[model samples]
Target: MTSIPWLTILVFLPLVGALLCLLSWHSAALCRWLALATSWGVFTLTAGLFAAFRQGGAGWLLYEDHAWIAPLGIRYTLGLDGISLLLVLLTGFLMVVAVLVSWRVTRFSAAYFALLLGMEAGILGVFLALDLVLFYLFWELMLIPMLFLIGIWGHAGRAPAAVKFFLFTLAGSLLMLIAIIGLHLVHVEAGGAPSFALEALRGTALPARVEPWLYAAFLLAFALKVPLLPLHTWLPDAHTEAPTAGSVILAGLLLKTGVYGLLRFGLPLFPNAAAASLPWLAVPALVGIFYAAWIAYVQTDAKRLVAYASVAHMGFVVLGLAAWNQTALEGSILQLLSHGITTAALFALVGMIDERAHTRRLDELGGLWGRVPRLGFFFLLFCLAALGLPGLNNFVGEIMILIGAFQTRPWWGAAAFVGVVFAAAYMLRLVQAVLWGPPRRRDFWPDLDVREGVVLVALALAALWIGLYPAPLLQPLQAPVADLLGQVPLGPGPGGVP
Candidate 1:
């Protein structure tokens, strides 16, 4: 164990920045610089952690534990496995991007930056925390800042969108809280020490009768965050109404938390339950893939279209997780990272376009290639990535997912293959409408500014890096994912258990 508490520093650094931003509420420039510098510092620290990280080492790294509420057996514990380290890096990277993109937010600037930093802190903590209570606190802590971001700084319909987002997430969280407490109670009842420690709880076997219900509670909370299928209505509205930075964070970081929770907590904690629920979960994931794609095809609002595309993309992630094999799970994690980079870039592009054009409707956006070639080119690159073009980040993850899903169930793979086709169709349509169609307005639209180009290029480079060389990313995930799969008993052949 390193004596320095690197994980604690990583988690709390953003909170410290937010406090500074709050203190300098009158100076927007100082606030922006503080938030940006803080975010970049966090990213730099994360890179250091990654450099020190040993691939295929023990499942948890940089472990930190401290007594808290000793009478109730609650402890403040934080650690990172390969899966979490990747997410922490993603969170830090996106926080920098969010700060950069929000450079234009002049309304209540200090509060806005403060909330953004606070949200980043919460997200980092959620990825790092090892105790159930600590995890839940970080989880709920994310909600308040996000709610304020949407409600205070978003478009005209922001109020309702924020409320819907809150209610859906809150309801799901309450269920998870019940499950968390119930799991601890089960530990106590089983004559074990009562603890909210995840590893400890994972060892407590509940009665088969109660396991399914408890698993369902956790699943519902995560699914809503994933916003899988029927539980996904709030996502489009929230994404469409939120400000650019808000949408970027929501798409890039928040959505992944759902999938992460499932892999980190839900599956291992209730292996049998997760195994049995695979088929049931697979159906909704498959449904979300096609349904969201179809909806995206008909959307006029460009932002809303991207929002729907997120649903379809995340559907692949859920399906991959349900497969519960090393290949599929690793692909699912890659998809989480790739989707975050690609989707956040797309949302950022849309925001930039909207800022200039004062509109996001596809009908109003055409022939941008002539006006803003730089912007159009980057948009095209991310679009190709989003559609899973070969040699792009999205392709690697999607192909691995399909192959893994096939190994589990031929039809599951086939259906997901069809979703890929749907993805290409809708994404191309979006491309054609926004970039190649006849000009809608004769007014000159400027290409990306230096700052904007830097943001898009950085994101594109990440996508390109992942696309060409994924071995480093894949290697780290192997042990953690294999550990997760080992928890679920397998049959002689594929798809035998479910």
Candidate 2:
């Protein structure tokens, strides 16, 4: 074992910080700084971990496993591959941003920051947990803080939206729990050690006939979280209602969990079933792409427009996953990263707009560029990134998805291409409405302050870095993605090589 189990430390540090925050309930300033420093500390450590992670390999390094609950064959297992590292970094980075963004939050400030940090910890666990039961615990743990954030600090209708979000996720989680137990039993029948470890379960060769049910259980759980198409009704409301930091994390980390689930478990464990469900799955994926974009074009509320765009962006993720090719899978993963950064920034910017103008109605606002050049610049930059303009991060992800999807099924890719066009339409429309037109009500249109500028600048820099030099970010995941594709059984690679 390495001298330090950095990954475990990264996972639990915030939780420890959260406990400390609770102990200092009366010291709001201390709570805020504590959360920020704790998050920054995690980010700093992960930066070191990324530097240490081996490139182009499939085995766990710095892995720490310990026996716990021996009767049930459970253990505390933690490891990080390329894919997990990026999300962990993203999680840490966004937590720092969340703290910075919430600097002005005065109501229940200590409790709010604690919950937010707690949520960040849970998300970190989701990305890093290597055991199935451990994964589920982190998965459900994510819902509570978010629900409270939305219900308590969220917008007017947040209470109802939070309830809907909770119920939907809980319902799907129940179905997934059964599926997980089923897989556990299957592993037992295969003579494998009783364990919830992902790597352990991957070795179990499931029977062909039962694969679909297992896939369904996993898919439904993730799909609800991703909120694929019909299941996505909860997202717009949640995003629209949650506070800025809540929305940022929702867009940045929570939504990615679904796509992460597909990549991490759905495709790998149930390859044949995943391949079988493509045409049907592709339908919603394609539908969501254009469907969400078109509706976004018509949305009068800026927040809702961004909410719908997330559906559209996630659709590309689904399409890429279904394509099951290297290009598509890589692209899908890239899309996940790109959308996380871009959407988080957009929500933060929108929150600033709403805070200043007391409204987010697109038609009612205009010409803020004159009042706030830096803010306007960020809004335009993020919009271009969101719309997949060349040279931005999303362009790389979306193009890769389209190319990969086209290689598998040209028509599906073609349909997705139209969604790309629709994305541009709405994004450009939003930019023009918010940043180009004459100030509809520019009186005292407050611009980005030092803190606000810090947040948006960080987001933009990430977008630029990922857009321009993605190889560094993408290389770590090559082993994991390749390992995942190798499981597909017929995806142009030898089995077990990924």
Candidate 3:
């Protein structure tokens, strides 16, 4: 029973489901139902994993390792720690949301569902893979399906958006590949058996001069995906052009991978370099927080506004990571989960609105509160959460991040506080315009049906759970985050406080 390979099954189950989806190519109904069932099964299995999980465990749990690509010393390794565990769970939950939101897709439905399942598999593998090479394989696997999702099924500007996304991601990926190969070469030269396994390579001393360059390569790759600052141009375009399911997955899951990469690989692999580069990273994060918030405040398109809001929210995650403290890291992780749920819900609502009104223009939408009371309530709930209102999910994460940042540097905290204010301004404006502004049309708009209500209610409950008591999530993260911090060269206990 101990040899059941649960992690392997979790990672591959969606890919198997995708194959099954292809078999029902002519039957869109079967394809949709099968995809929904498979995703829900995965979510249920993840819950089981959670129930059986040993809290406060020191290292990876449900560990499995196998030899692969012997010449390069890569292994088919998978495992979960507190950090990856939450992310894998988020991935599973969001896959269900993504599939449900796409329930109405009628054109090329089979291929669409299959691609969704395929992307879910890749995202799961990314969260679970412990081998660097295997991680890269999963990382690349996530791109293709998303590319097609945007290009084939997205809005009017899908083609250009898809191309832009592919190019930016490809450029970053190439740099990351170079860094991975460089690390392997360095290991071989150090008279060690070449290995791309994380445990094997972690803290492996590299030449001081070469280390910074390698860190930069990885940082650039991840920052681009985090789409940090100037590197974030592709995100708005991608979000605006993608279909509802694509946007939900992009905002909820794919973006988190970049932050995950930073925590998992960037800092731990090159602590000294990471410490040296903190200000460089933190400044752009701070700037992006304000920059994106201001841009979001002025957007005409509803989805585009939400897209920019993602940039601002993710900036907080970056800032927390740069702070390099346990509280900050834990807050960043919570932000990851909270942002995934809240933002995905927002996107789903926007999709519903677009479906009804056939327009995302803010000026064109108003006074919907009277027509779609259920949707209005959920929209306001998620909006409040997004703006960091007290007792909501985003508030908890943001407060912790600021507290942690202030401990590291008061000025960083102060600057980020301004971002919080701007967040409230922009989000409130959105709520006011979409729900209470003058009605652009008098036609009756339908409230959420049972399926949509179920989705929103589930997300609302998750948000409330985190806001009221984050300890369940925070407790599991403490041990792993503390362990990760131990590897870094900064902070009070590391011989010198930064």
Candidate 4:
């Protein structure tokens, strides 16, 4: 709709910056500054786009299309709607934090920073690309950088962890590719051009049996990324081994890709089947909440604890998605944002602690309050938020989810309520071990430096801002979500999405 090609710039600028960082690999400091500047520049553009966005229509806020592989009807298409805007903003913001957190890395630091920038580009591409092929390209782009980050920069078992992660994700993606090809062929069979553009492929009627199978393929692909329940084995290992920046990107942006894929392509393209799949979906999601909580509470390693907690948190988001109403969907989207912030903050803090004290084992960490009260305080704040403390970001999302789930199925709502209680228990257990339980070390650790303080405070402020006043975030989601849910047979909420 706009001639400026803003979405292209937003998606690829970091990629260009990555190249620049590699070229300047002679100095890590130069690369660091470049990554910081590039990430923030993207964030500034994201903020500007938000300010410029108008909400009168249910279509893309801005769209761009260009010829690419024209003979096959494939095109370079990118679009920005409210849903994309939020996720892209999240990617840009966390990327800045990732660079800052990794400021101390000296081993191939320039390469490290380059990979981080490349990660941002890949993630932004996934959120923006309107062509399924382009989307998959970006999706795989995310994998290579992440694999290197975990295997090269991570800890003792990084090798195996990286392998597990790569294998699981690739297997799921291959299945989804088959599904994408299936959809494209279906479109062609229906007298449409051979297009992989989401816009064209959408609504090409599937045979009753084929629809469910294709939908299941997309579901598994996204779920593996969401890493839901039993499929989530790679995350704890990946989180435990990855460097701090890698962990932040993993929790902050990488995990969201699955949920975003569902919202963007899976649900809308196969609405009735998606809605119908909820009953089966709910079982694993509900079970995963308790399973994650139980495993998280018993963990000795702090990072792995947060890793399992991520599974539980995402389970809530999955449940909200299964509910399929506007309230539940909105809550799912908000929780996606909230979980990204709180979990990334926690991992950052945990990484900082490991840097200081040489251990992430819960038994070895206590009395942090007496040594580093500033760090202790921020840790406590984010932990409470993770546990759904009232007036905190996660709570608002959790409450709305319960209400929405209750309206659709009271048992679902009640089950979620119990899950929240479980969340509080394990989350507080972590707080007790790290912040208030007992001193694992009497040696003093330095308090937050200016840079560290800046990162935590920024995360804290975002949590509080959204927790206390979520209207800004909620307002943009209204039409986009309405439009998304409108595709299903239950009812239409607003205009079309693709």
Candidate 5:
């Protein structure tokens, strides 16, 4: 372990704050301030971890372990390599911003902050936990707070969306739980002590007969969370109804957990299954790429439109992962981070619009760019990045994914290329209508306030930083990426393989 107990401190500090806030429930201001302090503290710790991380190693660093349920081989374990470290930081960064954004939600305010802090703790634990059971505990823990966020604090029809979201997630996770137990049994049967540590389980080779089913269960759980294709119907409603902070976290962090699980567990633990399912996986990803972009083009609601674009962007992520090469996996991770930052910004922008104008309908929006040029500009920047414009974060990841896709099959790249064009169409349409078209109400349009500007600027800076110099992000991930790839037997080189 590293000299600093970085992972534990970063993960649990928010939970501590959550408990403290609950203890001091009568003082809303105190609770809000404490929540913000805790979130900022986590972010600062993540910054410290970033500054201290060692790059280009064969395995993760700062690993910690202790027996939790020794009889069943479960342990309390946590660690981070570069990939997870970035996400942990992203979570920490957004939690603070979410607090800032929600500063004025005074109705049930203390409870709200407490739930928010608790949610952040669960999400951070999900990213940092190395034990399977530990990961699932965090995974399920997020559900309660988010349900409250959407149901208690959301808009009209919030209950339905919240219930739908809960049921879908619960069902998927249950299936995944079954798979986890099965994997543990396989490990035990292999003459290895039963263990749920990701590293320990990786050593057990799943039989070919059961690999596909187990892979399907695992992928289904993750894909449903990613809300891929057919499973994605709940997202638009959830986003449309969720509170601004909830929407931001959902788009930014919650969705990524699915893709993260796919990368961290799915491919590496069941490499042969992943390879076998590659053809099927690649098809939906490619189809979703174009379909989501087209749907986004037609959405009248700005938030729903952004929601659809997330589906489209995640298609690129799925394509990269299914491609199963170093470049593609790296690109997928980069895309995940880029999508998190940009999409969260977009949602936050929409939230600001709704807060001011009381609606998110595109037709009801117009000529704000002149009134809110600063806000419009930042929105445009994120929009361009979302569309994968060159010299932006999404572009880098998309290009890398495409390069990796092409290496696997030329047609996959070709399909993704078409999706890119559709993205341009919808995004430009959004930019034109909302920012530059005829004024909906010249008298009422107002520019961003100081707090809104702070949120947008912070997200924009992150997007630009990653867009310009991905090397820092990629370097630490190299070892883990290679470590993951080594588990899969990807046959011979391009020209040499049978």
Candidate 6:
């Protein structure tokens, strides 16, 4: 309805940037600057959209729909509500961070930036698309660039790790594709016009018996991406093998797509089935917290430890979704936005240390505070946030999630606290081992350079702002969440995250 094709432009701008990067592949410096400028432009555009966005709306603030294939009822549709808008903003912001973090990338540098931009476009497409077919297309779009990133730029075991990530995700995507087709066919058979439009297909009078199966299909796909419990084996490897930028996007954005899928499509399309599956889904989500944390604590490799920490953090997100209350969902979204900042910061720091020390092994790292005090200080800040320290970003989300869980089921709240304890244990141990003891090697490592400082400061500031006052973010969330609850309400409460 709006005049501008803002959503469409937002979706493809990164892609155009990607193409430009490819065209200039011979000029690494040109590619770097181009990627930086393109990413900043996207972030600026997205920020403008956010600022101009109307509050108190329950539907898309901006929407674009044009026929892609009329006979098949597929259309190029994108919807931006509060949820999609926040995530899109995240995609834009993190693309900037990803580029900045990759500033030092020399080998295949142009291709690397292109792939990052390509991945950005794909991720934006996923967040914006409203047509089932269109969404699926975007889903597939993101996969290839990420696959090559790990395979080409990653560490020693990149090949198998990349393969594992691809296969697991592809397996999930196939199921989701089948479910998409099945839903469209059902709508067609029920005397409705053939359409993959989410708005039209939602509440398709799916047979009660068939609903669970379809819902399960969607859940399996999302869960695998959520990497919930037993299905999560591929994630640690992917995280460990990936480059710094890869790890950032994998943790910050890609994993979020899973929960976003469930929030945007699966639950709304099959509300009854989603309600029924809550307890079952909760099992893995709740358990993954402690399980991953325990494993993280035992890891000697610092990078692998943070990799497992991502698993544990994702467990919190899934559990919040399982609670299905406003506070919990808000917390989950907060965790999504804030965790993207804090965790990405952690991975960036780890990468920085590895760059200097030539090792990510805990035993080989020590007394960094004596050498790079600023670096150690920032590392400590994000680590504290990750551990859910009060007055920090992670705490706000966790507390809200816990409150929401408590309202739904007291035991769920109590059990989740155990994971918080484990977080402190692991994070504290990391801080102590890395910053307190004598240097493992006598050679001095460089402190934060201008580029690294800018990125870390950006992340740190966001974390502090969210922790200090999340009201701005929380306020606009109500109307859309209320709309979602109208479709599938989990527990009784006020509309906002509080």
Give all TM-scores, in the order shown: 0.98, 0.96, 0.98, 0.97, 0.96, 0.97
lDDT over C-alpha atoms for residue 13 of model 5: 90
Candidate 1's C-alpha runs over 4 A off are 492-498
Instruction: Please report, as a residue range, the 10-residue window in candidate 4 with the lowest summed lDDT.
Output: 489-498
What is candidate 6's local distance difference test score? 0.89
- lDDT per residue for candidate 6 within 307-413, as digits (tens), equals 88988988888888878878888888888998888889999999999999999999989999999999999999999999999888999989988888887767788
Which one wins by TM-score: 3 or 5? 3
CA-lDDT, candidates in order: 0.91, 0.85, 0.91, 0.89, 0.86, 0.89
Residue 60 in candidate 6, Cα distance off native in Å: 1.0
Residue 286, model 2: Cα distance from true site in angstroms: 0.6
Ranking by TM-score: 1, 3, 6, 4, 5, 2
Q: Higher lDDT: candidate 2 or 6?
A: 6
Write out the backbone clash pairs for model 1: none
List the candidate 5 regions with Cα displacement exceeding 4 Å.
492-498
Give the per-residue Cα lDDT of candidate 1 at 342: 97
Model 1 TM-score (2 dp): 0.98
Q: Write candidate 2's Cα lDDT for 1-498 as tens digits.
A: 387778788888988888888887888888888888888998888777777773636766557788877777777887777788888888888889888888888788878988987888789888877788888888888878999999999999998999998898888889878988999899999898888778788778899877899999899889988868988999999999999999999989998898787778777778788767765788889888888988999999999999999999999999888777888888888888899999999999999999899999998888878888989999999999999988889999999888887777788878888888899999989988998767887468667898899889889999998899888887877878877777775544222211
Query: What's the C-alpha lDDT at position 31 in model 4?
Result: 87
Candidate 2, pairs of clashing residues = 482-498, 483-498
Query: Candidate 4 regions off by >4 Å?
Result: 54-56, 491-498
Show pairs that collide, candidate 3: none
| Better model by lDDT: candidate 1 vs candidate 4 | 1
User: Tens-digit lDDT track for model 1 on 330-353?
Assistant: 999999999999999999999999
Model 6, position 79, has a per-residue lDDT of: 87
| Stronger candidate by lDDT (3 vs 4) | 3
